[model samples]
Target: MSRPRPGAGAALLFDMDGLLLDTERPVFEVFVEEARALGLEDAESFGLSMVGLSSSICQRLLRDYLPAEIGLERFRERWDAGVRARLAGGIPLKPGVAEVLERLTGAGWSMVVVTSTRTVTARSHLGEAGLLDHFLDVVGGDAVPANKPDPAPYLIGAERAGAHSRDCLAFEDSDAGVASALAAGCEVHQIPDIRPPDRPVPQRGQAVHRTLTDAVAAAGLLV
Candidate 1:
């Protein structure tokens, strides 16, 4: 994908879990483990379907999938606990995250995180990953009326960065995230992680790359 030169002061919006932090696989493992502990036979499939979704939506889906006796709250408690235990040490950063952030910072681009994770949790994870300082703000799942694939989160993220959505460039690692950014009118580049982009090919000039490094490099940001 060729780079399009964004106007001066154009913002950079990012997705957190799989895009910036390598937390998706570990978290999905915890989800599968918790589900199987409850004797759910299709745990892996269900867990995969929840990728890039908001907590509320995931909870609602869990409610439908789990036996009434198990209860969503009880399942969430166990699943969240497992996630915490699994990530207790620290979240890992994806390759070239720090370098890209540093390069973008030097280039004077404003940056914001637009993630499906809750505000507090996203903040904490970014801090743990040593990436909190690079962003001007975070727009979490709970902060917007709707999550990814709806465009509200990215719209809010661009607003927080004090730029119009059309002026922002978004980096994402999921189909839902790419859709959100594209719908919000941002130039999007995706680096798929954990799961491939199952949705139809991106429209509006969006491109998918193998890694965050390749995405940014193609955008001419990593001179």
Candidate 2:
């Protein structure tokens, strides 16, 4: 893929869970506990499998590991209840999140959050983290027919930002997200979550960074 033009109207797109917010850890911990309660000993690995998936996709993926006695809907209800309880107080922002947002904001770049979370839930979590006001708009999983790894969400995100996909820099923490952004023609900077992808995601406009700060710098939007 070609580089974005210097004078183009550039936008900064971000993933929510493991990328900008630290909710994945607490959520996955709850998932493991729930899985173990259902007599699944290898719950940790099962929880890890859900890392970057949307709720819909996750339900499908989780069905393989869940017993028939514990159906997908019931499992989701239990996981939701547990995660909500654990995050009743507030969600933590990932390291360098505030600084990176501030830097990009000060530099006058348009910003949008393109996440695999549901619209209502994603908005609530962003509000709780005190980061909702930074984004010009949010494109959640429910907002698009197809989610990450399908590119529909990111494609819609660019449209929402009123910019071409190639004019955006998407910050992600999962291979699925990287693939989504790349497929949408956005330059993607991946900062892996707990477990990084074993192999490179084969796509255009893709790069990996150790941290959010590095991603911002690489995008040339550092203030």
Per-residue lDDT for 57-138 in model 1, tens only? 8888888899989978887888888888888877988988888888787777788999999999999999988889988998
lDDT of 1 at 28: 95
As a TM-score, model 1 comes out at 0.91
Off by over 4 Å in 1: 1-7, 196-205
Clashes of 2: 0
Residue-wise C-alpha lDDT for candidate 2, range 60-140, written one tens digit per residue:
878887887878888889988998898887798889998878766766678899999998989988988888888889889
Error of 2 at 156 (Å): 0.6
Candidate topping lDDT: 1
Model 2 poorest ten-residue lDDT run: 1-10
